[model samples]
Target: MRALYQIAFLACILFSCGCSDSNPSPSDDDNVPPPSGTSSFDIITQELSNDLTIDIYVPRVENASGKYPIIYFNDGDVFKGAIASLTSYKFEASSGIEPFIMVGISAAGHRYGRYIPYNDQWIKENWSDYSPGSINYTQRLINEVIPKVEEDYPVDTKRRAIFGFSLSGLYAAWAGINYPEVFSFSASMSPSFWVADYAIFDEPRELSNTRFYFDIGTKEWNYYVPMIESLENLGFRYGKDIFYYEVPGGIHAESDWASRLHIPLGLFLNGTPEEVEGYEIIKECIPSQSTAGLVFQRLNPIVTFTNGIRYSLSTSASFQVVSGDGVVLEDGRFDTKGGSMTVEVSHGNWSEHISLNNCNN
Candidate 1:
């Protein structure tokens, strides 16, 4: 599935490039040069007891004198390669997206501890090897990393954005929420919001000044539903101050995050939303053969928008047993009698019919 998505994403990029005649060919057009950029590695010892590596990418803007917006990434080493590729593609395409400086802060040796908040009980209880010093890590980023980067490069301080995925994604959200004065925008891809049992919602947040971009794959929808609800409860209107995308078949992987990097970049840099043309209903179920008949261990009804965003309606959608004495369980599972069963799931205006056969019989 990951390979398929990666291929599709790459194909989309190639197709878009091929369709545009305005884009000059690399061989024929010396006037239009490829997007030029330079990257350098820096070591920061002031922030932590040990040295930390920072990967920075600054795009060479031709004749543009203005300071550019900057994006700081968590798990810097993981995303360092994608940053250059994504920026080059966007720059060459002239997609109306502005280029920004990207700083990848490596997790170094203390990822689990540094990514979560200081003194997080969840980390203590779950990860036995959880190191301490998230507080120091955050302080180092604000007091040292940001300052050094700004001093070294021409950066637009007003448009600072933070990017992270997984645990780092949670860190990004926490940073934007807690330190709105520092980061104006946050993009969390497949954030592990289940951390500390959704402790992020324990207190009210003033989100008027902060913008957030969140996305999760349909497979990971169960973990993010609470965060989505909390954001809505906090008055975050989608496509307004916050953008949420539930990617169909997206998993907790770097490849998935890299594929959708353009969405948040375009949103933050160009204020453009990935346009939604329509939506399709996808029905999925995992069935296990029982002694009596067959049972569905999981029932997933996903609504995939044309824009590549997917929403899981499994828990929210209404389900009915259409035939064969099948019953929809309270836990959203399905059980069948001897022969076969069919279920119809409806959410809003979308509906899908899922059929399950009792192969055991």
Candidate 2:
């Protein structure tokens, strides 16, 4: 999102003879490229065994900026455009999650023809002709693509991620499962794990540093349920091996996946794949029993810095950052909503205290 700036220029025409017209500050009307300070991109063509075209989205950054994480999608055709559509960049522009360089690999149509797991006879019998036998695509991604993406982008290979849906969904899981050494996080939406014979978990070894997100709609599910059930069972056995989400009245359309796309995207890009069971949201809120006129309308998630210091919260609808330490750095209203916030804070050497005002009299 670009910031809107309205610079008004007032000209006093005291000696313009006949007439005087008010002229405001001329705005920047050039067709300049959006600031590439946050992200940029280039097309990569690989002349390997499987000649492939990789669409890399380079996160705009400086050399001093440390490495960022990578999130790759297999069915690039379906998932690439999804990046901008999901406003992932906008979310990054927001304060909570960290920015990531997203790479969407367009399936050049060979998607179904080439990428499938196990190449088992049962897969061929049940779901079309699934030629499985160590998906070479995974190898390309891990060995070649990873290197290529890392070479071009400032990426931390240790924090790589992969995600997909349907056919590629299965590819995502299989690649991450079979080659855990490559992807740190993975998510499968309505994966065809049921397409194969032996269950996904049963055919695996101890998973390391790999977190999975399994999601499916509850509606329009006649055969998908079994796959979901099997995954849930496996997750139970494997603990945080999977992050399962049973979307109520879920559908197979893009609308459903669209609604839930951010879940996996965020998780893969910036979440700990920890085993979570019976999630209970504990909202320790200081009720807005304001007896005064000033009050907050909304309160987003409180931000926690890696420095082990937690920010103070104001209310439910939105929280105002009172201060970094205890001194006020910003005077008057400081906002963080609609991409901005109003606040008053103090500045100090290392730490200061946050003093919040407007508590109902």
Candidate 3:
């Protein structure tokens, strides 16, 4: 059932009613013409006998000439297709986003080793398969890739940004946190925060001018909420320097991430938050539907704004047992007594009621 739903969602993303008329399909082949007003090329970097392919995309702004900001992407080969397509669409539509150079750094064959942090214990345990080269990879990117690009192109070095998803998303966050001087912005899409029991949080972080954008799908497990809270604890404000988005009905697939890529791109390039006129609250019981004999674990209230940005109000929202014998635990979970129960959840000016029935049919 879930698989079928995901297929349908992907179809909506790929072939939405007006998408064909508005944005043409992007080509995956390098030999094909690149996005309009954008020049594309590739570079090879050899490190430790591994050849890394880096794809570069530079958007040409006619009648306006100045140094453009640059965004570096991990998992170059996989994301370049979507990046190229979106670049073309934005250009054709006159999206008003500032021009920027894109650098897509391919992980090549050392993805697992290069994406994970060097101090991660998982890589140490699986030393044979994933060589100890994460630190080296980071160094190469900072010292090698950035230098090569800056030397060849007219770029705004101060406004550099890093972007990645999943494990590579973790890398993007790590780089931004550790080297804010190098990357002023970082966009992490569904990062693997559970890696090495969340050891990334243990690393020391200093307050800086760096901005971060984080997001996860509602259909996916809530592994990134804690990371967002951690950033808040470090003095990062929502919709300001740090942004967290809960994508409604989104999944862990690349197609899902590709569809909403414009959100981060607009935020970083234009430096404006989408205006919110209204919002809808989506209540989801952790298990959705559970066996009658099972206990209710958790209830998640996701607030999705009219701007299409969603947020999980689980930690900050107030949860109260409205009517039922069920008890609201101190940890915010409801204890069902094999009967129907209703809970009222409130956040800011919004309130919603969620009813659960554990009674056997």
Best by lDDT: 3
Clashes of each: 1, 34, 0
Query: Against the true structure, candidate 2 has what lDDT?
Result: 0.47
lDDT of 2 at 198: 29
Q: What is the TM-score of each candidate against the true structure?
A: 0.66, 0.56, 0.73
Two-way TM-score contest, 1 vs 3, winner: 3
Ranking by lDDT: 3, 1, 2
Predicted model with the maximum TM-score: 3
Model 2 lDDT tens row, 1-361:
0011111111221111101112111112112223333334433444434546666665444323477877887655444434444433433344445656777776654654445665555434433454453466776776877787788667887788887766567677777767777788877776555434424544445536677776644332212223323444444232234455545455544445655676776666555433222121112212222223424221112222342222112111122355342221111223333332233322211222233333232
lDDT of 3: 0.62
**For each candidate, what is the lDDT?**
0.60, 0.47, 0.62
**lDDT by residue (tens digit), candidate 3, 59-91:** 655214578788899877655554565565444
